[model samples]
Target chain A: MSTADRRRLLGPIDASPLYSDITPKVHSSVGEAGKSDKEVRKVFIKTGLVSNASGSSYIEASNIIVEVSVFGPRPIRGSFTDRASFSVECKFLPYLKQPQEDLFRGDTHANNNGRQGLTEVEHKISQYVETAFLPCIILEKYPKSTIDVFITVISTGNTTAPSSILNLTNWIVNCSSLALIDSGIEIKDIVTSGHIKYLQSEQRLIVDPLENEEREDALDCLVSFESLKNDEIVGLWIDGNQKLLTEELLSKFIKECSSMSEKIRANFNNYLLKLCEN
Target chain B: MQEVDQISFPPEVLSRIAPDLSLERHLKLGLRPCLRSFSEFKPIAVSSPALEDEPNLVGSSIVSHGQTKVICGISIGVVEAKNQSDTLNQNETNSQDSKSDGEYDAEPVYPVVDIARGRTGAPTEEEMILSQRLYEWVLQSKIIPASALLTNPGVAIANQTSSSQGSSADVTILYPEDSDMPDLFSRVKPYKFVLYVHLKVFGRSGPLFDPCHAALIGALKNTRLPRIYVPDSSIYSIKIPIRSRGNFGHRVKETRIFIDENQDLSNPLQLNKDNIGGASNYGLYDLSPGSTSMDVDPNVIILADLEGDAEEAECMSKLNLIYNPNKKSINNISYSGGGMVLTKDTLKQCFKLAKKRAENTQ
Candidate 1:
């Protein structure tokens, strides 16, 4: 019983790619020269993009582009439950190459087929977003229902930073928060996340760092918070070598991450205020 | 009697319906559902290199943490280096850490984790997440050196002077540093061994990440890669029809590599032992103000080495740390606060306990 895709035609094995003589244009990096590391790249977020979905949001920050749609609070066909069941599914465009994907996910043979199940990177991102939102959403309000979040990654940016996924996760969390709000879901508070890269040797923390050099060892941390709930952390992910970690260093990461989250929260508030005006 | 049955149920029943209440009851008794203390961890038992004897496996390990068992086996494959200088240049520019110093290169292992739950289909979400995280951590830690898997390809030469003229050809191997190139060496392409890790978990209990990581490092410590070689006549050019709009035909040269069957000629895989660390998981649970009989001011308790289904479902706020004892350093930390807020004190406590556990394991 062969399960291979028979409908879709695969390219010839010996076919050579058509070459273009025009040289590729390199886009300037998000953080231009002389820009302060404390400042983050300008983000463009808009909600209600998908007409068919209950709620949708499209966010573009630098080269990373993400679209999230929220569906549910709709009735389920299964047995009755006390609280709404929540699930998140994330997928990247078949052609979109994830950052350092080769190192983490070596099986590129199955990449050409669009019908394949979610890759490891997509599953991981989905789990992170799901974990972050589970505590914030008041699922009990919509009993015997289900809430599903579907995220589509259009582009993952060209940054080679090891923390690129964390950056993408940060944006996805924020966009999902907006989609949830637009759906009129009864969430406790808005969940906004912040990502930072900490350089051990330089003793510096770059808020919303977009790029990482291979020569420099950095501690990348992403923290999500529901600010209204006593600034409680809803989710957290930290990556890098632990040898550079100290009690003070860990404390600093949290403090910096929360501050960054606070800034994003202010931006969201302004956006929502304008949304009300219209 | 019917009302009484509804009010009070069995321990197992209660654990399933209301896991939080069940956990609180256990905590009041100064023990967990697994019968271990709040700070106690399940001791790890590693199998005595039994899988190392398998001919197909380059290295393998079976680790049991209490009731949970994880089996990890590594296999090898050879890949031709597309451009040798490109790899060398990247290594030169990226040299920073003492573990992955510019002199040697480091690559990640391809890992696939399968937890036997009596079901066979696509990998579960847990398996996919764990496998991905494991791969990322291995690369970030820079434990596996590329030089260790870099093969010294042997070139076969015909023994014309020997009486047995049609017998096996004499092979000459070239090491990485060898610069004295013969005419045949120019055609010889550099090759590297890729390690594929297969992890199988049984008696799955609690968070599988910690034990899965332990088993992988355990297996990697014993890996010995076999020598590989390419015959002098391995490289051949063939013309294939190009179906593109601009091209008519193209010629491609390919090489076929083979592994040496002689067991004694293998070399142990070099690993950055100092950077290798074991993972520990802790769940933070907040005591409902006055649930406990004892008056503890700081109600948040960090439970070490989480086990069983009740604790996993109840404790949404988790702290996972990978600590290296030799350097007394932390390699990775993933803490998610589902309910309880992670205070500085709680974070420090987890690090302290994780470091202690790592040191004791060594």
Candidate 2:
């Protein structure tokens, strides 16, 4: 059938309404286990999860789970002779509630309208990871080739809470780093990420705040640091009600978040040693 | 390790390899395979008021340069902002009312863009990115002034006159008080319009943004909004009589308005000239009072449109500039891709060329 005839055969298309649901109530100020605000959640990491992939790693923190697979140093079709091209693809299972649309108000423009396999949030996440990791990779050694990193958020905690998304993103970065290392690719250093939240109500700073403990108005910052590069921050994303934060407070939060990354980096190194022994 | 054996080079490997060698050879000579200079743009042909037989579309255009072709069509609809009470209840439940502040902010009219590449089923990442970039560029560049989409332009004129006493040059030309003008001043309620831009790219050009932008500009230039007559009472209560012309029908209740497909397509809202007196030649709508006119510097050359081959070559770094044809100044400038640092002189030349191109096309 002709395109128009096919369209006519189908009923009137009701493009899904942009505003799908109202923001749910913030359930509580404490987490499920009544975890303290300062206590960082324990992270579980596994390497070589995908035998077929060049390198693969899976990480779980509380209810958040992410898996990363790395492939290549394989020949690239184009004339990328000077350096290797890097590409990242991030996907969230359809069943998960994608709250990313709500965080950035008026994201009506970003909606793909069920057009792309990857949602808008997935695109942004992929782009973010690609940018953050591009500087560290030794691309010149793999000239005319490409490295592909695939990240999958198998499960995420508290989709409604904005902090959970940040937490999930941090886990993805950490997992990808482990996957790249396991792949035996030439690299700079291991990268670890951490998130810190500034609670406005109590005027307190919480490192690695749980989903429930994330205040709607709290200032949240997520920073990724290179473990061996003197804790140099490779990526930083900050968002919240900016009007509530002062210059001093914002910088202070960054400092604390950067320091928190040191701990994550050390733990990641210990995990790497454990994996090698096994 | 087993999956590695199954992996194969993409089918385009041969085509890509040949082009890279030739593209580099030509770049050394400062010429493209098409024999165009580094700064020269490919021949661009834009057909506006296209698809006139299709009554549903308000404006449509076809833009082509070399092998790249893009078709842009615009559809207009009236949408009411969601009720405040529903959000207020949600806010009350949350206790922290700050999150609801977004509701009070002016509702922006988001233009939906659908790009159809070779793939039919789902939108590719490239398409999504292009749509988003187009949306942002349109808004950030203020290409379509918010005031242009008003239900009643007469109110805007009155507000302009009262706000700025003697600086009435812009408003007088936009809404001329003439016999042919519709008596929309009697309506107290104001309405906003949503534009859905449907773009279809025929071939896989290196970058689709430039062509899409030009086609959108051409299509928007060709667009004509209809004069809506809102009835008193709930729109649902009134049964709209089907009409033959342009699809335009609307009904208004206490706070809600409903529109049907009964528009007068014959009488469309004009973009180049005033509909009433047909005297003033103000291209598009007038600039709001107190807005500064953009100044174009005349030194550099602006590549108006890039062809497929040129774009694939050394044109790694691209700057897309949107200009106001009437004011002779740039409305917005966006930079994409990364390579080759542009100098101040080159930047100025780009804007000058953009302004020149806008004038020629309009």
Over the true interface residues, superposed, what is the Cα RMSD of model 1?
19.4
lDDT of 2 by residue, B1-362 (tens): 55665644442452355655455555455555556775555556778733322223567777875556566766544543234343324335333323342222222223333442212244566676777766666554444533345453222232333444333223221222343545544443444455667675644444666677777767777777654333322111334444335865543322222222234422343232211010000001111223343443232223335544533454555676666766556666667655344567667666666666666655
Candidate 2 TM-score versus the reference: 0.42
TM-score of each: 0.51, 0.42
Clashing pairs in 2: A115-B123, B233-B253, B246-B263, B246-B265, B247-B263, B248-B262, B248-B263, B300-B349
For every model in order, the fraction of real contacts preserved is 0.00, 0.00
Candidate 1 lDDT, B207-232, residue by residue in tens? 88988898889888888877666545
What local lDDT does model 1 show for residue B121?
51
Model 2 ranges with Cα > 4 A deviation? A1-32, A100-118, A161-163, A212-216, B1-245, B248-362
